[model samples]
Target: MNNKFGLSNEYTLAKVLQIKHYTRTLFSFKTTRPSKFRFKPGEFVMIGLILRGKFIFRAYSICSPTWHNALEFYSIKVPNGPFTSFLQKITTDSSIIIKTKSTGTLILDSLTPGKRLFLLCTGTGIAPFISIISDPETYIKYNEVIVVLTCRFSQELRYFNYKIKQLLKQPHIESHAKNKLRFYLSTTQEPYPYSGRITWLIKSGTLIADLNTYTLNKRDRFMICGSQQMILDVVNLLKSIGYIEGTINNPQDFVYEKAFVN
Candidate 1:
């Protein structure tokens, strides 16, 4: 039997505050956050629903900053996909099941002190970075933040780009965002500019060349989220260059998370 909004023992119900559809397959929604619920900028939590008394959930990275009163998530609509398909039914009047405890390898604590932080992602992998980039703590931790994203189509990039642009316009952070944050965007299936350089943009030095920034130094840190292959490719390249991975993250010169939600 379904309660007011499908209750579950391990999860709390959050009312949907708003929803925005960026594309036919891509959408973002906000939900009320429980006062005691807490998570780091890059953490992900289980979100889903209880159907027929069975709980179905998937890991979704929190897209909003830690200080926000509401939690936000960006999702891709996979046709007939497990959670995505079921998720299509929810609306502003709906309530969702959110596991209180959140966890992930992409948190800032995993990385040692560094001067430059590179956030590399593809497609919806950009979710966690959104929170990371907007967090004031991230600005305090690193002098510069560079975000690189690639997808098959330009529309797939609207979320990250829009969020970054929006952040640049905000009042207090405007100066820091403009002076410290940089974005490189591109589309693989088509010709568009992003941070990627050479045949493998994430692993190449082309971004520094294009940006006229300082060369890659040991003080630079990296965080990656994307397909498994993309993660492996970037990790291998970083390790080959002697970048030590986070000891907390199975030893990578970088930290990574697989966000294959589609």
Candidate 2:
């Protein structure tokens, strides 16, 4: 891909080994890794490929943890989407581009000390939380890690459910997240054990019951990722409950990032 605009910085084409559907169009890919590359969990890198002399680029979160040798990415396959149209056709052994530098503001360091950690996500927004929750640092810093994922169907929940279950089973990590780690799911389109939009769930008190916990407090740190509306709604909820926005320059009670979608 041409980087004439200086938008492309890193060059990588690890072969795709696996792909699976999350929802109708959302999917996840497991790719081969470059041995020399190292990146912080939760950061996003600009990815693109050259096709017919033109390059298409997009930012995707590195969903795998630092400890894993392989790289993982979760994405939405929009019909006729500039990148997704081509990306969805990928299969095992397919090569995809990845930049060298992965950067973002969703890391754990963005928050101050807190006993409760809340990871609020919707759609592909869950990407970063997947990385942070797997990392040992998350459990080491917080007494509890509560992840609330909002999606339209249960299929999209598979990857996250598997990861959370696996992480909870690891003896070394279990102790840190035993009573600490929790997964709260809200399905909007399909009926499951639990169903509704996250905003509705939170407003109607279902979220509290799902979490089996009390309202958010100052000691609780939060991270939100989703669409513009979802982020705004969640932020409003946090504010109504007295949560402050956190940042690297000046730490506060919560952190957030807008998962890019076009």
Candidate 3:
């Protein structure tokens, strides 16, 4: 396959270690990681496979923390997507291609130090936040971590719910999350206790009321990932409240990335 694509040095082949299906359109898989592949928890890298004798790659956020030996990715299975249709069919031991470079704006370093870190996500946008929360440095940097995930269905929230429970059981993470971590799940099209777009929740003051915390302030930093419209809505709301957009070089009060490029 390497010879066929002429990608011997450009990409590394990783063996699929495990895979789990969360829904017809969503799944997660872990793959062997190259020892030299290092990246911040919230970074994203290009990954793909060969199909019809051609290399097909797509940018995907790394869901696993840097401390983990293997790499994990949460993906949406687009029925006709050139890369995902092929990716979703892989099983254990299947080989995949991962580019060596990883980059993104969602890392903790992109935001100024703050008392609370709010991770706002929708759909598979939860991927990068999974990595951020798993890293110990996140706990060290902020006194509080709040994760808000909104999806269209109740079942879509299952993976995050299960993962958070397991993460909270780990000896090191358990202590930090005991008092600092809060997870909120909401659905848009399905019946759930919390329903509606996150922007609405914020505007209605329902979110802060539920958390029993004061409204966002300068001490509260935010990282947002989701659909384009969702990101725009949230960004506008934050800016209206005086939150400044941040970057790797210029640390500010908030940062964001699109879940998938349209």
Candidate 4:
């Protein structure tokens, strides 16, 4: 049953704005904006539908930043996903319910200033990191910004690689990013140019080799967004190395968010 507002009680059909294929079944969408809606760079919102007279919802991070009028989302077409099975078929102008408020703690505002910023993401979890990298303020606050993306294979990195290439070409960030933005893509399950899980890379001391950098120290800020186990592991490693969890008011050495449950 659709809400009386002709949408979900907490969200509304914002309209499918755009769809682009990355790999086999993975696709991304941009939707119509909700005038009353507002969110920070790394926040997330529930997106789904009411089906069989029942409401089904799933949390998805907003790939678009608050500056844009429209909401953007990058989703995986799970084989029989309750929502994506239907969502993937949608095209421009199709309606999609979206919540009014976007919320999450994996934002840059939750971390204290540091000389370097490391954003570690896996699969779709890269969504929020995309927003932070695009924001100009990120460059202003930190001297270095490294985005380490771990995926099952290289094809899955195509979409974001294309996007990062485009962002680096932009005049506003091109020159400024010399000492700021960098992308380090890795694949574990399938063969690719870069291989190995991020955890292994860290343990083997190859992460810095890949980035050609020094060791992680208190002067480094970290944001982990990925699978539950991945988050816990990375968080534990950071803490063991002297980093601390942070918040908006009590910004510290690190921040984290689980991309999704398996």
lDDT of 2 by residue, 10-39 (tens): 576678888987567878888877658787
Candidate 3, 61-111: lDDT as tens digits? 999978889999999988798888889999996989999878888978989
* Winner on lDDT (1 vs 2): 1
lDDT of 1: 0.81
Q: Model 1 segments beyond 4 Å from truth?
A: 1-9, 194-199, 202-204, 247-252, 258-262
- On TM-score, the candidate that comes out on top is 3
| Poorly placed runs, candidate 3 (over 4 Å) | 1-5, 258-262
Which pairs clash in the backbone of model 2?
10-100
My TM-score estimates for the predictions, one after another, are: 0.90, 0.88, 0.96, 0.91
TM-score of 2: 0.88
Off by over 4 Å in 4: 1-10, 258-262
Write the residue-wise lDDT of candidate 1 on 9-85 in tens digits. 55788899988888889888999997699999999999977676778889999998888899999988999887888
- Model 2: weakest 10-residue lDDT segment is 1-10
lDDT of each: 0.81, 0.79, 0.89, 0.81
Q: How many backbone clashes does candidate 1 have?
A: 9
lDDT of 3 at 161: 86
| Candidate 4 residue-wise lDDT, 124-152, digit = tens | 88988877877788888999999999999
Preferred candidate (TM-score higher): 2 or 4 = 4
Give the Cα error of residue 121 in candidate 1, in Å.
0.4
Model 2 regions lying over 4 Å from their true place? 1-9, 168-172, 259-262
